[model samples]
Target: MTTTPDITLRSRLTTDCELHLPGDPGYDTARLAWNLAVAQRPAAVALPRTPEEVADVVRAAADAGLRVAPQTTGHGAAALGEQDLDDVVLVKLAALTGATVDPTARTARVLGGTQWQEVVEAAAPYGLTALHGSAPDVGVAGYLLGGGLSFYGRSHGVAVNSVRAAEVVTADGALVRASATENADLFWAVRGGGGNLGVVVALEIDLLPYAEVYAGMLLWDRERAPEVLPAWVEWSRTAPESATTSLRVMSFPPLPELPPFLSGRDLIIIDGAILETDADADAVLAPLRALGPEMDTFARVPAAALTQVHMDPPVPSPAVADHSVLGPLDDEAVATLLAQVGPGTRSGLMFAELRHLGGAFARPAAGGGVLASIAGDYALLCLAMAPTPEAVVAGKAAAFSVVRAMAPWAQASLVPTFAETRVDASRFYGDEEWERLLRIRAEVDPHRVFVANHAL
Candidate 1:
């Protein structure tokens, strides 16, 4: 008698779906994440088409004595780590892609595997927008659970706050509805609580009424960063909440496919979106415009076009990165930050970013999720990619050096989605809140079947 766990699980799963076991034909592709750098070797990868299928897979995994982990696009695979997959069965939701927009209800119902890009396209025709992140390719389920910080974030607050409902498959194979009026406790835990609670199969989320917007990016050469960066900091203080912006310094690789002007160059770029008139947008950006950036693409574009403004790499690639939330940016802190990652520094990071946070983000919602607010005036992120393992090690070290220097002024907490590296869950929540999250986790996931990256 051959005693194989994968074969047993396969026999238990619905026959209509796909399951890739180790050495199976599609196993490699099924386990790949968008980052490409994180090596994921799950015991088995299951593609479930419906919530029923997802629940079946979870229960089957439990029966086979295997932990379950659900991955949509695998954007945060690194944080899941090599150890997390040792005895895990990964549920891939690619086949569950479904998005429906209710223009009358002013909301959208998105399936587990749906990407933000698809939702944005679906809702654009209705003159409405979902609270999506900078990168359109990120999965909707993971983004919302991590307390998503969006371009519209300053104006609308964290994306998780807009979640009206979620359909989840718990560890016991029970399909539960979580909302303010439903399984309310589970609803609060899933929102901004990472994915440890259960597998979210679908979500009903609110949408913004935005037909068009004045939004785009401005770029200045690296040499001018010292002057322009501090100026942006000063300007951000008085900028209206209607406008949201971030400053980033990056060194572009010499890739032929890149634009001639941007290829193989280092530059400082300011990207933002404003829910206002074109003239008002220009007026808000006047001071920074006076700095004479080398490139300016700000204009009145359809809300759907906002996805392209961030210039994120559209395809999967290897990358190493880190993230943090910083206290207020003072003159001295600004100077120190620039000197480390600025033009003349030996930093190997591809991009170093600081997003201005305030306005609606500073206020707390009465019935909001565990992550009520980010607790910092700005959020900082550093990212890098290299071809070789040796280069990756060196590049990451350089990035961390700069991040470490900024630690004194940094907040202990960080958004779950942006928690690229492993840290204690305490860094993401206060002592009491963390304890409450643990109690909730114990209540719903007694066996701890659902494994999530940087999970509680």
Candidate 2:
């Protein structure tokens, strides 16, 4: 049975903001996410312009005996199951895309709805940069909340550590500030915790002093995998904290939308950024250079260009992704991965990646949030196109098999953003951390008024 929205609540929400029901003209468009596979169906959708407006919307939902779930860009929508979103008020904050940088303070105050691309452009002129994700179009709030893993992470730390403050509208319809000093508990809970405590409207984050860097991709045919893949792994063992890199094996189908170099090709690519000079990058990449990759694009580029170095899809596409954080990769683990998704496996996966993890990422901050460091030293992400429900199931199974083969080395906990599929709380937090998260959630949201894509 469909729950009809309370008319009084709907009226209040629509007075200053937008309120769209299932049958409304723009409801479908408002509910669409970056991943085209999941079709979102909420009881109602609201787009609030300001923090006060967001609080009002939450109050309205509370008054109507409904819960609230917020989405900035919906890049990680797979975690929101239909049951969790049912009778939930979906708050889309696309209108709150505002950002200001304090060049002297080396900080940026970004509205929740803002994307990384906006912040990169704004900070570039000042010679400062945020700990942005691989995709320029990814929303700042969602990425930061999930303890973002940035191209700069190996040098700096997880993006959450850079957060100075978060302006949040809590379940009680009260607007509050969360930081090291103010609303301290909420501050601790939100950094690595998913958006379960409340809706974040704005964030104050520390910026890095980086104007340019050496960054790009190197590609090789799959036939060279046996030699090249292991060589990259061995070289990564001695790589410095100044560099961040990942290796990906991809099969791109013929499509007019794809770039000529990538379309209808099966290739292995190494992509990353070295914070220092070109000489430093060349020295670090010397081992791989001996193999002579078919294509190499490494060069000194603006730091903003790091956002697209991984070549993440620039548009919405139908796909499913699975993840696993694993122990250090050895010859055995590398061979196991190849047996499942390599050239002749017919794995059906579009791409499989292994990100080298260590450096600042392995150390805990003085007063870090819930996730101090990922338990393992490397992370694997496998994705496949799923054009239909059946394809989604098959694709997910094939991708998971690769992870299962490496299960012995898999970490017990997952990096929040990496758990793109519908995973339970255990997959993201340790037993103690999980209980602490629940206690904090209950204390702040007694009525459980807010629901995140991945609930604790």
Candidate 3:
């Protein structure tokens, strides 16, 4: 049955939080997602400023027989847009932002809607940092819940492992704390289950000890990809756990706002972090540095600066992407990739990247969540700008073309965070782990009141 939220639901929600019903003046703005490409029209949109207000909205939505989808920044909004959300209430947590760093404990507690940059800035003064994604605007709850992959991943493991606790509002509209010692099962599930079981209101995560680190990027004209790609692949196989890096073949459109080096240019770039002494980092980077990059910015810098090393767009962008985890890139694989986006190819993709994986990334955390570790040696991500509906269609096809061409080198598994579309959720976990997640989802959200981007 189609359910239109009744007036009672609106009254209950608006009492404690801002509620935007369909046709309301603020409805359109309230429903806007970070990725403008996704046109999500939920039954209602709620802006909750506090944990209590979050619970109020969740309870009200559930009482009205409407499902609730919790969204923070909406970087993963593409997957949610794939579903029917007419009966869903999008709880936008944009206003629910704050971060507190406990320097002595080396941990940071961030509100549900907090962005990575907020936490990084908060912890930087204490000479600490968190396992954040390349983009500073990504929300903490969603990233960590999806088994975040960071530049520090090779040495510290996936970002989800750093989560010490999460305060979640369950389907019944009760705010409960989940940690190793409290609600252990929920904690395990929330760590990697996305938002299937509940809406995460706050997260207390362990922070990295480094105040400064050697990190930066290297750039070369696209013509060098053939020479650079294979060499980086060979070097990655022997690279130590302390170093994590990614190489991309990128194409930039001519835009006045962009730097002269990047505007209207096709380039190959390598960037990441090396958690080692200055001498040791130089030694490890010597082989790649030998490739003669046109620009080399590697040096010891404030750890907080690592978030900018990837040069992710400083603002929200309309984009489409496809991802696949890979075992290892052989000569055939390298040649195939070159055929798609290398030198003379006119592939309309923004970039096709290969992120080095293994080391700590491959080993399961000692006491981790369902997504303890990634099984692949590398992750392949292809993306394109999608500024228009036609562009979105073309971008998806462009991104998928590269992914499909590289299938021979791809793995059956996937990194949840890198997956831009909804795929086989089971592929993101082991058979036993998948079964466990399903069981937990049943117990915590039996009625399916909570909708997640990648539902279990």
List TM-score per model, in order.
Answer: 0.96, 0.96, 0.98
Q: Pick the candidate with the highest TM-score.
A: 3
Q: Model 3: clashing residue pairs? A: none
Return the TM-score for candidate 2, rounded to 2 decimals. Answer: 0.96
The global Cα lDDT (0 to 1) of model 1 is 0.85
Ranking by lDDT: 3, 1, 2
lDDT of 3 by residue, 199-239 (tens): 99999999999999999998999999999999999999999
lDDT of each: 0.85, 0.85, 0.92
- Segments in model 3 whose C-alpha atoms lie over 4 Å from true places: 1-7
Instruction: Give lDDT tens digits, candidate 1, residues 348-448.
Output: 89988998888877666678877766678888888888557786687778768878888888987887887777777778877777888888999998988
Cα lDDT for residue 175, model 3?
99
Backbone N/Cα/C clashes per model: 0, 0, 0
C-alpha displacement of 390 in model 3, angstroms? Answer: 0.7
Candidate 3 versus the native: TM-score?
A: 0.98
